[model samples]
Structures are given as C-alpha cells and as structure tokens.
Target: MTIAMGEKIFHHQLVYNDYAKLSRNFFNLGSLLEKIFKTTFLSKSGTQEGENTYMGNTGNKEIDVQGIFSSLPNVPTALFQSQCVVWKDEILICGGRPHNHHCYSYHTTKRKYKKICEYPHTIRIFGHVVVKCESDNNELTLLSFGGVDVSKYTLLMSYQSVWEKSRRKEKKKNEWRVVHHDTSFGTRKSNLTGASALIGGKNKDLLFVTYFPNKIDVIDMKTYHYVCGTGSNRLPIKSPYSLQNHCFVPLTSSNQTVVNHFLLIHKNLSLLIKYNEEDKKFCYESLPTCPSLATCDCYGFISFNDQIFFFGGYDASAMTEIDYIFIYAMKDRAWTQSKHSLPIPTRGCCPVLIGDGRFLHLVGGLAHHRTQAMHLATTVRAFDQVCFFFFFLSVIHLVII
Candidate 1:
C-alpha cells in the first residue's frame, strides 16, 4: 500500500500489457509461438497434463473477444443458488452458500428454467457441487462430487468432495451415482475440502482429482491411484486448486488428456500441476516434496492454455490484473492477453466452462462488490470467431461531381 510499492506494481502491470499486445499481434504471434515451443522452462520443468491447449490451429480462428455476451438483458429470475450446468439439454442449477431447496433447470429454446431435480433434504448444503456433463464411450455422465454440508458428518468423512457419478448418457434413463462418501460434505472423505475431476476418457473414462488437505487422486469405475497433488501428508489451509471457494468448465477433451492433470487456484497463487501417468512411481506419484504453505489457496483459475486466466480477487494492487484475460502459452512458457475483457468483475460464482474445445460457454456465478450484498448472474456467454469480407464503395456519379 506504499507509494514505492504502488509504483512497482504499476510497472509490473504495464509490462504484462506490453507482453499481451506482443503475443496478440498477428505478425509477431507466429514468432512468439516458436519462442513458446522452445521455452527453456518447459525443457526443464514440463507441464503436459490436464488442461492443455490445442496449438495446432483448426483452420477456424479463435473466438472473437468482443463486446457480445455482456450486453444481453440478464432478466431477473427467481432467487437461485450455486451454479448451473447443461443437463439433458437443460440447464440444471443448484443452490449454494445460504441454503435453498430449489434444484432447477432452464430451457434455452423456451427461455424458462423449470424444476427438474431437487435435494432430498433441506439445509440446502453448499456443495458448490455440480459440473458440466461428460461423456463415457456412449454413456454421457455428470461427475458429481464435493459440496459443503455439516449435517451429513455422521454418514461419511466430514471434509471431502463426495464422490459420485451420474449418467447423462441417456436422457430418458438419467441415473444418479451412489453417494460413495456417506456424508455429502465432510473431512473423513474430503479432508476439509471438496473435489471435482476432468472426465477425459473415451467415455467418462478418467478423473484427475485434487483433494482438500493434500493429494490428487485418479479414479475410474474400477481403480484408484494418486495422480498429482500432495503425496501422503495433509496440505496446509486452502488445499490445492481449492480455497474458501471453487468451478469453471474444465477444458474437457477426447484427445490425449488425463484424469490427473489439474491446476489448483487459491487466494494468492495459482498452482499449475501436472501428472505423468506413464511414470508411475512412489517418488514420482507424489508432488516434488513441497512446503505446507506451498499449497495454500491463491484464488483464480488458470486458463486452458496455461495463461493463468484470472478474474477479480481480494487485492487492490492485483486489481490491475482485473478485466484482462491472459493466455499463458504453455508451449512457449509465456503470457498473453486476449483482445477481449471479462464480462464483469467475477469475484464469486464459478467460471466453469462448457463446450467441445471450439465454443466456450461461461455461465452463472456470484459477483458482488465491497458495498453490494450479492447477486447471481445466469447470463450464458458463448465465445467463437467468424471471418467476413465486405466493401463499402457504393457511390453514384453525383457524389463525384
């Protein structure tokens, strides 16, 4: 908060701005990509696990980072809770923080979110649970895990991202996976935190899981193993990728992605961790022995491309980081910003992404200022790009005269 520190912070931000422009410039971008691929840090410490980007251009240009999604009238709806995810072609939403008993889904085509599912009990536990639907072979599933509920302590571990997998494979026969950890939200199973996974299987095949205290485990229908996270000891306050909060649409892929590859966001640092499934060993299985505070929660999500894509958090100097979406080109080991800006100051709520690599759909989340109580936004923003050509020279002879 000092003048000298403020000046240093301003300089740091200005540097990032210059870097973003350089990374985005069309002429320099190619050379920049080359530099990214040859990054020295990548050679020494490589990150080829979860949430990798597709550097290979699909001929289709990247999404247009423009003022499109921010303008829609976010029509007021019933007091909702938690976040929303696409379910059976419907948007299924859960309540969070303060308890609420309404589990609903909205019909986009019809423009009305109706009641589809509901929690069996009240207390409206804040699972902060629920994620976008995933596919397994032919069966589509929603990998349901952690939430916050102190009432279910007797049933299972008290602090855990409860493990469950519901089938979104068949809409007609939609099924819910059994609650593995008896209590919906608690420690025995969760270790004072919750868990979610990137379902990167041919058909919901694998889950790269980050535990509360410490440890990132990989789970499937049959087997389980520690992929990446902490080894055996408990992580410090604010587990990996966990904090006082958590979701964003994981960059789910059918390609060679894994269940162990994940990034942990906390209040200060955004830890980017990856797993080597091929190198399964006692020492390798565990994260390079790190300090307790090393795993502390530093709020903000790392973008799919390793850009450390951040939104609003609890800091003013870091406020300079606000409104900017930087692309940390993993291939080059550098950061760049998009031509676009965040729709709003996304302090709370989930930045969960939902799409097939091509289109990124940003959905509901909580965004409140220092003065405001709280507000939920259901405005679904979709990102993609389009190339058009036009000429504006339709003039008559009178104009020339």
Candidate 2:
C-alpha cells in the first residue's frame, strides 16, 4: 500500500531498460541507470563487476556474496578452541575458555539456538573433543573427552540418554554423566585433545582418545572401561609414529567383520594405519604430500564428499592467522587449494559440512583484526563452492565469445 519514492524510480528504470533496445540513446541511459540501481541498493561485501581472486587455485572463483558475515547468526559467546559436533540436523557447542562450562545446541533447519544444560564440571576444557555416539538400541548420545581441567584431571563425560520406550515425548533433555576419570590420562600428565572418534565395535562403539606426543586410549562404550591399561600403555599399536597435535579420522571401506582403519595427519606425515586381525599387527601406508605446507598442525578437518577438507590454522613463527583452504581428493590421491579464503583471518575454527557437502559452515574461532588485538571471533561464514547456475551461464557465454 505504501511505496517509497526510490522504489517507484527503480521500477520505472527497470521498465525503460526492458525497451532500451529500441534506441541507442535509450540503451546508454538504461545501462547507466542499471549501474546506479546496483550501486545504491544491491551492492554487498566481496561483490565486484569483474573477476575476483582471494587465495588457492580451485578454478574460476567468485566471492560468495550471500556467504558474508552478516548472513549468519552470531554465537551466544565469542568462543575459540571450543568443541563442535554435528548431530543429525543440530550442532552442539561444548566447553571452551576464558573458563566456563556452558553448552548450546543450534537447530540448522530453524536457524535458531537454545542454551542447553552445562557440562557436569564447573571448570572449562582447554582443547576438548566432542563426538556423537549411537547404541544398538537405536539411541543417540554425545561423548566429550580430553582437554585441560587445570587443577583437576582430564574428564570423560557422556550424555545420559532418556530414550524410554514408555515415554512418548518428542523432545528430551540430556545431561552429562561422568564415565571415566584418571590421573595417568588426565591434565597433569597430558593435555589430551588431539583427535578422537567413536568407531563401530563388536557389541558396542569404541571411543579412541589420542593424547599428546603420540598416545591413544580405547574406551568401550557399553561399560565405559578402558580396553587395555591407562594412558599410553593402552594404545594398540607400538609403532614409533608420534601423533602430536593432529587430526584422527576413521575410514570404513569395507563391510567385513573388522573395524574401520584410522587416518592420522601430523606434520609432513599422512599415514593410514589399519589393524590386521590375522597377523595381529598394524599396517601403515604413507600418503603423498598434497601441498607445499605439508601439514595442518592446529587446523580442523572433516570428511566431505569422500574427500578431506583442511582449513583454518595459525602459522607458529609469526603467530599470524591462515586463510588457506585445501581439499584432498580421496579417490584421485591429489590435493587442490580452493581459490577462496575465509571471510577474515581465523584459527581454531570449526568447519562443518552440511547438505551434500557443497557448503561449509565455519563456526566461532579466534581472529586477528588490524585495529585490535587477537580475540575470540563471534562471526560465522558459509562457503558456497558449487556454482551450479553460474557455471552453466559462464559456459554458454564462453561459447558465444
């Protein structure tokens, strides 16, 4: 019912531009008017009329106009070195510092967040690992492990599932239950926050917690007991592979009785270690070094589209943030850098793959701004790499050219 004067003018200009082909002067005026219209209202961050380049070399790239900082909702707190896990359609945000035990869950479909129950402990975890676990009863749970507890030891907490058959509630609240705690694998000995995951086992799932300086502990889910001894003595493999601050991912290529193989990524070494049941030994394969940097020290990685995407970490010497995004194609055994960078320089950020793995949603982390000191970043960014319509249009325009 009410239209602004600028809206009326824009409508008139659009109508005139549709008929501009009738005259030369009209075409020139219409083109000028269109430029004015775009500059006045349609302009956004990282959008240019010509080609744009950021970093990496993943073909013809453009700044994701819709994937800017303003497009995402801010986290409740500016958190870095926090734990993030994707459960079904929701994302769980766990403990982090400046020392607090608050937790949150973000509903991806609703695009809203709700503060969930806090962690069982009062202290904060420095570098924690959180994972989603499912049981044989078809129930889902969350397991959190590792991280420095300061005066206290490292703690292992699992969500107490309330999946009662008689209770017919659509939504249920879960609480963190202390499953295991020990001094040997705790904070005094190691700040065990390297890489972790819940792999499928014979009767239940097994959680593999990797400690610093190359050590792993396998915990049985059903009993919440260590499969072997505590600390470094519990690890299955005695190889000299020191899995310092690295990322551990499991690969399941077969449906056989044996469990999945483990992939470890430390500096200069990308090894795929699998357990040989018959020989009772661990087999390790050295993968090709994909890029020049040859490592992702404090970076984050997630398996997407059958590939591993490594992004967001800081360079140690200069203490500067990194914007490099690399992708390792599993089948092709090759690596390619993406031509786009983060919205800003970031480290300790969590990259979660959503919906068919075309878009990567980067969560909270530490960022360095030119005007201020390094601080926890509250901004979120989405990277849209699948240029479906743009690619088709560009191909058609190229043939015409």
TM-score between model 1 and native: 0.51
Residue-level lDDT of model 2, residues 1-401, one tens digit each, is: 22122112212233234433433344354334334433432233344653222321113432232222223455677666667766656667776654447777766655557776777665446666677765334345666666543533334434332223385434443556555453333435555655455464544466666666555556666666666533233333334445544667765332222364766666566767665433434556877665544434666566654466676676655567777777665666676676555655566767675554434455666655321111111111222222222333344567699
Regions of candidate 1 where Cα sits further than 4 Å from its true position = 1-66, 71-81, 87-89, 122-124, 131-140, 147-195, 200-206, 220-259, 267-309, 316-324, 352-359, 369-401
Q: Please give the lDDT score for candidate 1.
A: 0.35
Model 1: how far residue 194 lies from native, Å: 5.6
C-alpha lDDT of all candidate models, in order: 0.35, 0.52
| TM-score on alpha carbons, each prediction | 0.51, 0.65
lDDT of 1 by residue, 32-89 (tens): 3323322311111233322122111113322222242311112223221255554334
In TM-score terms, candidate 2 sits at 0.65
Estimate the Cα RMSD of every predicted model relative to the unseen true structure.
Answer: 15.0, 12.5
Model 2 lDDT, residue 229, Cα: 36
